[model samples]
Target: MIEIRGLTKSFHKHKVLDQIDLTIRKGDIVAVIGSSGAGKSTLLRSINLLEVPDAGTIRLDQLQVDFARKTKADVLELRKSTAMVFQQFNLFRQKTALENVMEGLIVVRKVPKEEARKIAARHLAGVGLSDRMHHYPKQLSGGQQQRVGIARALAMQPKILLFDEPTSALDPELVGEVLDTIRKAAEAGNTMLLVSHEMSFVRKVATRVLFLDQGVIVEDGTPEEVFSRPKSERTKQFLANYYRDQEPEFTI
Candidate 1:
């Protein structure tokens, strides 16, 4: 379980997060939804200590993460249990798909070279990229490269995966493949915290949903409760505009 209490962050004099408290159970897929700059990305980074919090505590299982008291060593250890995937697929341009996935296992985790390669192969296959293992990031399509990114994260065997707008950079036709892969992972019991603009995908995959506005989570509940019956007017208004372009039309 992950528990966050009184979490707060600021940039210079501007606050990006304020007194945020949330709990994520093991094997749960929680989607964080909000407009741009609403602190969704910042919140995920704070949990992994990538973005230091000015105040508050983050607890993962029995491990306590106090950003205020954290050292370089402490942050490194915390990151091993939590891995992040960015919207842009950050793979090495010079490396093959398999090598890109194995980079972390060999460098940070210090696994043996041969063993890491085997593990990398398995994960690449898991993401449906077995044949593309020899391909470089530039050689593959956007969706394929993102799958490589996912494989790289999976090879780390993190307890929690944080996705910051995973499909935001993909073309419309490519989005479904990445989302499908994520859906399969969630079904197979991978704990995840996702920051996304895709409402329909969130509605289908998330067990719980968080609605944030102005650096605070205004609504938090099951997908059905939050999306279909939001308690706040801000949430309702946001959803109305968000789904406006996607709503179907009928002709008499």
Candidate 2:
């Protein structure tokens, strides 16, 4: 289980996160949904220390870090338990898909080079990128590169996988493939926390959903509850606009 307590953050004197308390049970696929500037990305990033919290305590199983007093070693230890996939497909342009996935394993984890290769290959294949393993990021489609990013994170076997708008950078036609890859990962029982605008996908795969407004999680419940019976007015307004253009799975 992952426990986060009293998490808070500010940017240039503007608070981006309030004192947030969240608990994620194992195998929970939690999806955070909110309008832009609702602090969705910040919340996900803070978990892996990508955006350090002003005050918080995060415990991932046996590992714990108090942001107020955490050292570099504590930061690294916390990071070791989680892996993040960014929206922009942050792969190395100079490396092949396989190499990008193997870099962390062989360098950070100190796995043998041959062993890293095998592991990377398996994950790349898992994301349906086996044929593109040797292709560089520039050579692959946006969706393919994102899959490589996913594969790299999967190769870490971290206790939790963090996704920050993983499909936002993709073209509309390419979104489904990346979402499919994530669904497959979920089926494999990888605990995940994601910030996404894909309402339909979130409703379909998320075991739990959070609605954030003004840096606070105002609603948290099963997908059915949040989408169909949201208790917060802000959540209702947000989903109304979101589903206005499509066939809504959510009742505004």
Candidate 3:
């Protein structure tokens, strides 16, 4: 399990995240949804220490770190337990899909080259990229590149996977492929925290959904509850605007 307590972050005196506390149990696929600038990405980034919390305690299983006083080693140890798949599919331009997946294993995890190659190839194939494994990121479509990003994260086998708007950069036609790959990962029981605007996908996959607004989680519950009977006015208003342009799976 992962526990966060009093997580707070500020940028030039403006608070981006404020005194947030949450817990993610094993095998829980938690989806965070909110309007733009609602701190969803910040929340995910903070858990992985990409955006260090100004004040907080993050506990991953038996490991804990106090962000206010954590040393570099503490930071590294925390990072080892989490991996992030970004929206932009941040693969090295010059590296092939297999090399991108292997990079972390070979460099950070200190796995032998041959072993890393085998593991990377397996994960690339898991994301349906076996034939494209030898292709560079630029040569792959958006969906394919994002699948590689997912593969690289899965290869890490971290305690929890973090996805920050993983489908936002994909074209509408390409979105489903990446979403399908993520769904497969979820079914395989990888603990995940996803920030996404794909409400249909969120409703289908999330064990729990959180509605974050202005640096706070305003609503938290099952997809059926939050999407159907949201208690917070802010959540209702947000979802109203969100579903106006698209068909919501649940009545808003």
Q: Which parts of model 3 are misplaced by more than 4 Å?
A: 247-252
Question: What is the C-alpha lDDT profile of model 3 across 179-219, one tens digit per residue?
Answer: 99999999999999999999999999999999998899899
> Would you list the C-alpha lDDT of every candidate in the order shown?
0.92, 0.95, 0.94
Look at candidate 2 and tell me the lDDT of residue 56. Answer: 90
Q: How far is candidate 1 from the true structure (C-alpha RMSD, Å)?
A: 1.2
Please report how far candidate 2 places residue 235 from its true position, in Å.
0.7
lDDT of 1 by residue, 1-252 (tens): 999999999999989999999999999999999989899999999988888999998888878878788888778888988888889988999999999999999999999999999999999999999999999999999999999998898889898999989999999999999998889788989899999998999999999999999899999999999988999999999988977868777657
Taking all chains together, each candidate's TM-score versus the true structure is 0.97, 0.97, 0.97
Q: For residues 98-160, what per-residue lDDT tens digits would candidate 2 score against the true structure?
A: 999999999889999999999999999999988999899999999999999999999999999
Clashes of 1: 0
TM-score, prediction 1 = 0.97
